[model samples]
Target: MFPIRDHNPSGRVPYVTYALLAVNIAVFVVSWFGLRSEYALAEFYYTWGLVPAWLMQGEGYSTLISHMFLHGGWMHLAGNMLFLWIFGDNLEDVLGHLRYFLFYLACGLAAAALQVAGDPGFDGPLIGASGAIAGVLGGYLVLFPRARVDVLLIFIIFFRVFSIPAWVVLGIWFAVQSFNGYSATADGVAYLAHVGGFIAGAVLVLPVLLRRGFWVQNKGKPPHPAAEYLFSPSRIPRVPKR
Candidate 1:
């Protein structure tokens, strides 16, 4: 299951979220052409992607930050951007532009650090904005535990969209990452980095969340309210012919 959208509406416009989405897409387009040539792609990744082994050797430390902006392929970029688009605006609305940007970078750095720790001797290029986006998911869960997220579920030739609590969606995602991290094989993904970024995002937002009285205000309420759209819920057909 993957989230398609959320029911919660932001109290304010999220310009920063839009800007971030634009930047990520622009960067991906530029990098896509580079991937056409193997040497060019390698050179690009060498300079921008995070290499755990190089970092362990006490060099190219900046890649930890740069890698968050680079992605491996079209699907990778699309998935990350889709997530950022869905959950980022509300957080940006709550945290404001500057603070949200800082929070994102910090989470990315922490994620890379965790990945490095997971495999200090492994030599491979790590590229993607997933870690930073994972951070956004973490923050979203803490701030909007009761918010409703619409998840698109696929089963063979069948597809359906269902609404569920944010806590349930994000909680399941974290559990999967932890499980995969522990059971990873030789050529598997770095599930640990995703977990690390998620943890970092949640922890880093604690102070701000506390200061804003989020814990108290959100005690028994959902994050904001259901989104107001041109069409009403009645437009949806009832299941089982109602």
Candidate 2:
């Protein structure tokens, strides 16, 4: 099941979230158009994307941060943006824009580090916003466990949509990522980065959550009308203007 939307919304405009979305798209467009050939594009990614061996060799250390903005392809960019669109604003709402921005960066860095640790010698270049988006998913679960997320499921053209709690959705996601992480075949998905980013988000958000007394609301609550933030047309049915 894939999350299409969530009922919980941000309390204010998520400027940083919007900015990140714009920047990611912009970077991809520039990289896609500027390169003349496939080989050239690959070289670009290798230069900007995080290569664990290169990093461990005391070289190209900047890729840890840059790689998060560089996606491998259109679907990769779309999937990551969709997750960010669904979950990021709420975390930004909870953490405020600046802290949320830093939180995202930290998660990405931790993701790269963990992936490097998992296979320190892997030569392939890792690139995507997924690791950072995974962190947003983790933070969302901690901050809004009870919020209803509408998931779109498809199996052999049998399409279905349903609403479930954030915890359940994120739990399944984490389980799948963890399972794939230990699997025998490497599909080049960077499961370790996903796992690390998710954990980092939860750990980093804990203190802030406690300080803000959100721990008291640990049970989570249903979304209220006032909290509905519309960055775009929500997948959930919108109430008509009276």
Candidate 3:
């Protein structure tokens, strides 16, 4: 299933989110088209992408930040950007632009650290904004647990769009990442990075949530009433007049 959009709307434009997206795209274009050859691309990734083994040796430390802007392929970039677009604006609205940007980078750095901790010897170049984008999802869950999101479910040839609470979708995603990280032996994907980024985002947002009186003022609040803005199930089926 893929999330298409959220029913909850932000009160302000998310400049930081848009800027991040632009940077990621620009970097990808430079790497793909501006670089002289495939070898140059590989070299660029090696220098910037998060490599656990290299980082453990006290080298390439900047990759913690740089890797967040690098992506391995088009689909990888598109997926990460989609998630960010869906969930980031609301967060930026709540946290303000600067704090949100810092929070994002902190989560990315923490994610890389966790990945390194999970596999200190791996040399594979880790590339993608998934870890950072996962961070945004984490914060969104905390701030808008009851917000409705439209998800497109794909089953074989069957497809459907449904509205569900943000908590349900994000919670399931986090659980899956943790389960996969623990169960997998080989390190093809950075499942640990996803888990780490999520944890970081959640933890980092706790102070902000508390200060905003989220728990006190909105305790046990149901999904924001605005969720109805997207779609609501029909109470009565259409009847034909003859």
- Winning model by TM-score: 1
State which candidate has the highest lDDT.
2
**Which pairs of residues clash in candidate 1, taking residues 3 or more apart in a chain or in different chains?**
none
Backbone clash pairs for candidate 2 read: none
Indicate the residue-level lDDT of 146 in model 3.
79
Q: Write the per-residue lDDT of candidate 3 for residues 68-172, one digit (tens) a residue.
A: 999887988898999999999888988899999999998898888788898899897898888888888888888788777889899999887888888999999
Query: Runs in model 2 with CA error above 4 Å?
Result: 226-242
Q: Taking the tens digit of each residue's C-alpha lDDT, what string does model 2 give over 1-242?
A: 79899887678899999999999999999999999899999999999999888888999988888999998889999999999998998889888989999999999988887888999998989999888888998888887888888888889988877778889999999999999987834777999899999999988899977897785755575334423434533487879999
On residues 183-230, what C-alpha lDDT tens digit does candidate 1 reach at each position?
Answer: 874554678889999999898888877898886887724556678544
Q: Is candidate 1 or candidate 2 better by lDDT?
A: 2
Poorest 10 consecutive residues by lDDT, candidate 2: 225-234
Clashes of each: 0, 0, 0
- Candidate 2 has what TM-score? 0.91
| lDDT of candidate 1 at residue 115, scale 0 to 100 | 83
What C-alpha lDDT, on a 0 to 100 scale, does residue 80 get in candidate 2? 95
Error of 2 at 241 (Å): 37
